[model samples]
Target chain A: MTRFANPKKFYNLSQKLIPILGITTLLFFAIGLYFALFHSPADYQQGESVRMMYIHVPAAWFSTLIFVFMATMSGVAFVWRHPLADLLAQEAALIGAIYTSIALITGSLWGKLAWGAYWVWDARLTSVLILLFLYIAYLALKQSMQDKPIASKMLRLLALIGLLNIPIIKGSVQWWTTLHQPPSIIRSLGISIHMSMLIPLLLMAAAFGLFFLTILLMRTQTRLLNIKTIALLKKQDQLDDPSLAA
Target chain B: MHIFSALLKHEFLLLTRNKEIFFTLLLFFGLSLFLFPFALSSDATLLKSFGPGLLWVITIFTILSSVESFYKKDNDNSLLSFYYIQKTPFILVFFTKIIAHFCLMISILMIILPLFGLFFGLELKSIVILSASLLLGTPPLITLIHFAIALTLSTQKTGMLVLVIVLPFIIPILIFGVGTVTFYETGQTLKQPFMFMAAIFLFVFAFVPWIAAYALKESARQ
Candidate 1:
C-alpha cells in the first residue's frame, strides 16, 4: 500500500485499474437496478415507492463512507506528511459533497411519499443536512486559503473536527425521537431487512463504493497531471529565458 | 500558571485598547435584538417565546462578525510570534485568548440581557435562565470561533469563511443553549440540557485549543 504513496506509481496503477473498476461498477449497477426494480419484493405498505430505497440508502451510505475515507486520508496526510494523501483528500471532498446532496434529495423525495412531508426538522434529517454543510465548509475553506501547505494542515484539522458528526448522524435516530426510521440493516439484532431486498441494496452499495473510488482516482490523477504540467511549463519558461532561472 | 495569568492580562489590555470594537459589537448585539420585534410583532407573548432562541442566534452572529477584529490586531502585529519567541506554549496563548474573549462576550451579554428582558418582557426567572445558559454556552462558542479564526488566519475574506466553517459546529451549542431556557419554560428538567452544554464546553475547551494552537503555529510558518 505504501508503494502507491508515490503519485507517479499510483497514477500508473490507476491507469490500469480505472477501466476494470469502471466496468465492474456499471455491471453491479445494472444487476442491482434489476433486482431493485423488478425482482425484490416491495413493502406491503410503501408499495412502489419502496423502490426509492435502493438509490437513497446506497447514496446515503456512500456519502458517510466517503467522508470517513476523506477523514482517514487527511489523518494520513497530517501525520506522515504524505502529499498524495492530501491530494486524494482534496479530491474526495467534491465527490463526497455530491453524494451527500444526492442522498438528501432522494431521501426527501422518498420522505414525501412515505411521511407525507417533503421536509421535517427531525434529528436524522437535520444531522444529514449538517453533514452537507460540513462538506461545503471544507471545500470553501480549502478554496479560500492561499497557502497550500497550511491549507492542507488546517483542512486536516477541520476534517478531524467534523468526524464528530459521523457518529451523531449514525445515532441521531437512536438518540432522539425522530421521524426517520432506525437502522434496519446494521443493528445488533442482525439485519432486519429481508434477504431479497438486502442483496440488491448491498450490491448497489458496493457499486457506489467502487464508483466513488474510481472517480476519486480519476480526479486525483488529473490533479497530479496538472501539477506535473505546471512544473514542466515553468521549466520551459526558465529554459527559454535564462534570467528567469533565478 | 503565572505565564497564563500574564498572558491573560496582556489579552485584556489589548482588548481594552480596542474598546471601540468592544462597544461596537455590543451595539450590534443590541440593535439586532431591537430589530426582532419589528420583524415579528411586538406582542409580548410572542417576543417572550422567541426571546431565548433569538438571543442565542444573535450572539452567534455577533461572535462571527466580531471574530475578525478579535484576532486581527494580534495577528497583524504578529503577537503570536512574540509569544513564540518568549517560548510561551501555543496552547497557553490559545487558552488566554479564549478566556479573554469569553469575558468579552459575557460582558456584552450582561449589558444586553436586561435590555432583552425589558423589550421581551421576560420574567426574572426566564432572564436568569437565559443568563445561566449563555454563561455555560459561550465558552464553547468562543473556543469554536477561535478555532475557526485560527484555522482561517491565512485566508482572505476570513470573516465570512470563518462563519461558514464554524456555523455547522455551533449548531449543537445553539440547540443546547436554547434548550436550557425552553425546557425550563415548558417545565421540563433543565439539568439535562445544562449538562449537555457543559459537556460541549469541556470537550471544546480540552481539544480545540490544541488544534487551534496547531493552526496558529502553521499560520506563523508563513
Candidate 2:
C-alpha cells in the first residue's frame, strides 16, 4: 500500500489492473443481472417490486463503501502526505456522490412500490439523504478552493468529520422505528437473506465495487496527467522568462 | 490564561462594536418567525404545535448568518497569519470568539423567542422548554457553523456553502432539540432528548475547536 502511495508506481500498477477490473466488472454484471432478473425467486411479500433490490441494494452499498474509501484515503493523505491518496480521494468524491444519488432515487422508487409512499421521514431514508448532502458538500468544498494543497488539507479534515455519518446511516433503522427495512444480509450472527437473493446481491455488489475501482483509477490517472501538464507549462513559462521564476 | 482572557475581552469588544450583525440577526429571526404564520395557517393550536420546529429553523439560519461574520474582519485583513506568526493558540481564540458569539446571539434569541412564542400562542411551559432546548442546542450548532466557516474561509461565497455543508451534520442536534419540546408536549420525559442535545453540545465543545483551529490555519496558509 505504501509503495503505491507513490503516484508513478500507482499509475503503472493501475494501468495493468484496470483492464482486469473492467472485465471482471462486466462479467459480474452479466451474471448478476441474469440471476437477478430470471433466476431468483420472487419475494413472497413484495412480489415484483422486490426486483428493485438487486440494483438498489448494490448502489446503496457502494454509496457508503465509496465514502468510507474516500475517508480512508483522506486519512492516508493527511498522515502520509501521499499525493496519490489525495488524488484518489478527490476522484472518489464524485463517484461516491453519483452512487449516493442512485441509491436515493432507487430507494424512493422502491418505497413507492413497497411502502406506498414516494418518501418518508424514516430514519434510514433521512440519514441517507444526509449522506448525499455530505457528498455534495465535499465536492463543493473541493471545487471552491483555489489552492490545491490547502484545499486537500481542509478537505481531509472535512472528510474525517463527515465519516461520522456512516455509522449513523447504518444504525438508523435499528435506532429508530423506521419505515425502511432493517439490514437482512450482513449481520453479527449470519446472513438473514435467502441464498437465492444473496448470491446475485453479492455479485452485483462486487460489480459495483469493481466499477468504482476502475473509474477511480481512470479519473486519478487523468488528474495526475493534468497536474503534470500544468507543471510542464509552468516550467515552460519559467524558461521563457527566467525573471518570472523568481 | 491572561492571553485567553485578553482574547475573550478583545472578541467581546469587537462583537459589541459590530451591532449590525445583532440587528440583522434580530430582523431575520423576526421576519422568518413572522413569515411562518403567514405561510402556514394562523390557527393558535397549529401555531403552538409548530412553534418548536419554527424556532429551530430560525435558530439555524441565525447561527449561520452570525457565525459567517465572526471571522470576517480577521480573514479580510489577513490577521489570522499574524496570530500564527506570534504563536497564538488559535484554539483558544476560536473558543473565546465562539463563546462570545454564542452569549450574544443566544441571549438575544432567548429574549425574542418567548415573544414569538406568545405571538404563536405557546403555553408558558412549552416556551420554557423551547428556551432550555435552544440554550443546550445552540452551542453545538454554533461550533459547527464556526467549523464550516473555518473550512470555507478560502472560498468566495461562504454563506450558502457553509449552509449546504453544515446543515446535514447539525440535523441530529436539531432533531433532539425539537424532540425535547415535542416530548414535553406529549407528556413524555424530556430527559432523553435533553440529554442527547447536551451530549452533542459537550462533544462538539470538546473537539470542534481543535478542528476549527486546524482549518483556520490551513485556510490562512492559503
Candidate 3:
C-alpha cells in the first residue's frame, strides 16, 4: 500500500487493474442482474416490488461505505501525505454521490410502491438525504478553495468533521423516527432476508463495489495525467525562455 | 488570561464600532419572521405551529450571514498574524471571538424574538421554551459555524460554501430546537430535547475550538 502511495507506481498499477476491474464489474452486473430480476423468488409479502431492494439496498450500502472509505483516505492524506490519497478521496466522493442519488431515487420508488409515498421524513430516508448533502458539501468545499495544500488540508478536516457527524446524524435520525413512527415490521435487512434474496443482494453489492473501484481508478488516472500535462507544459515554456525560470 | 480578556474586549469594541452587522442581523431576523406569514398562510394557529421551525431557520441563516463578517476584517487586514507574533494561542483567540460573537448575536435574537413570537401568535409559554431551546442550541451552532468559517477562510466564496458544509451538520440542533418547542406545546416534558440540545452544545464547545484553531493556522499558512 505504501509502495502504491507514489503517483507513478499508482498510475502504473491502476492502468493494469482498470481493465480487469472493468471486466469483472461488467460480468458481475450481468450475473447479478440476471439473478436479481429473473432467478430470485418474489418476496413473501412485498412480492415483485421487493426486487427493487437489490439495486436500492446495494446502492445505499455502497453510498455509506464509500463515504467511510473516503474519510479513511482523507485521514491518510492528511496524516501521511499519501500522494494518491486525496485524489482517491476526491474521485470516491463523486462516485459516492452518484450512488447516494441512485439509492434515494430507488428508495423513493420503492417507498411509493411499499409505503404509499414517494418521500417521507423517515429516519433512514432523511439520513441518506443528509449523506448526499455531505457529499455535495465535500465537492463544493474542494471547488471553493484555490490553494492546493490549503484546500487538501481543509478538505481533510471537513471529511473528518463529517465522519464524526455521520454517526450522530444517523443516531439522532433513528431516535427521531422511532419517537414518531411505530417500529417498521419489514426490517430492510437483518433476519428478514432469506437465502434466495441474500445472494443477489450481496452479488449486486459486490458488483456496485467493483464499479466504484473501476470509476475511481479511471478518474484518478485522468487527474494524474492532467497534472502531468500541466507540468510538461510548464517545463516546455521554461525551456523556451531561460528568463522564465526566474 | 489577560490576553483572552483583552481579545474579548477587542472583539466587543470592534462590534460596537461597526454597528452595521448588528443592525443587519437584527433586520434580517425580523424580516424573515415577518415574511413567513406573508409567504405561508397568515392564520394564527398555522403560524403558531410553524413558529419554532421558522425561528430556527432564520437563526441558522442569521448565524451563517453574521459569521461571514466575523473573520473578514481580520482576514482583509491580515490581523490574524498579530496573535502569532504576540505568542498568543490561536485557540484562545478563536474561542473568545466566537464567544463574543455568540453572545452578541444570541442576545440580539433573544431581544427581538418576543415581538416576533407575539406577531406569530405564540403563547408566552412557547416563547419562553423557544428562548430556552435557542439558548441551549446556539452555542454548538455558533461553534460549528466558527469551525466552518475557519475551514473556508482560504476559499474565494465562503458564504454559500460554509452554508452547504455546515447545514447538514447542524440539523440535529434544528431538530432538537424545534422539538423542544413542540414538546412543550403538547404538554410533554421538555427535558428530552432540551437535554439533547445541551449535549450537542457541550460536545461542540469541548472540541470545535481546537479544530477551528487548526484550520485557522492552515489557512494562514496558505
Q: Which has the greatest lDDT?
A: 3
> Considering lDDT, which of the candidate structures 1 and 2 is the better prediction for this target?
1
Q: How close to the true structure is residue A62 of candidate 3, measured as C-alpha lDDT?
A: 90
Off by over 4 Å in 1: A168-191, A237-246, B1-6, B81-87
Pick out the ten consecutive residues of candidate 2 chain A with the lowest summed lDDT. Answer: A182-191
Q: Look at candidate 3 and tell me the lDDT of residue A103.
A: 98
* DockQ of candidate 1 relative to the true structure: 0.56
Q: What is the per-residue lDDT of model 2 for residues A92-183, given as tens digits with 9 covering 90 to 100?
A: 99999999899899888878776677887666677788889999999999988854668888888889888964563344333343222444
lDDT for model 2: 0.83
Give the alpha-carbon lDDT of every model. 0.84, 0.83, 0.86
TM-score of each prediction:
0.92, 0.94, 0.94
Q: Which residue pairs clash within candidate 3?
A: none
**Candidate 3 lDDT, B1-222, residue by residue in tens:** 888898898899999898988888898888878887999999988899898899998888888888877799888887786666666788887888888888887778877888987798988888888888888888888889888899988876888888889978999888888898888877888888878887888777776778889889777755
Provide DockQ values for all models, in the order shown.
0.56, 0.60, 0.74
CAPRI tier for the interface of model 3: medium
Candidate 2 scores a chain A TM-score of 0.90
lDDT of 2 at A96: 92
lDDT: worst 10-residue window of model 2 chain B: B192-201
Interface RMSD values for all candidates: 2.3, 2.1, 1.0
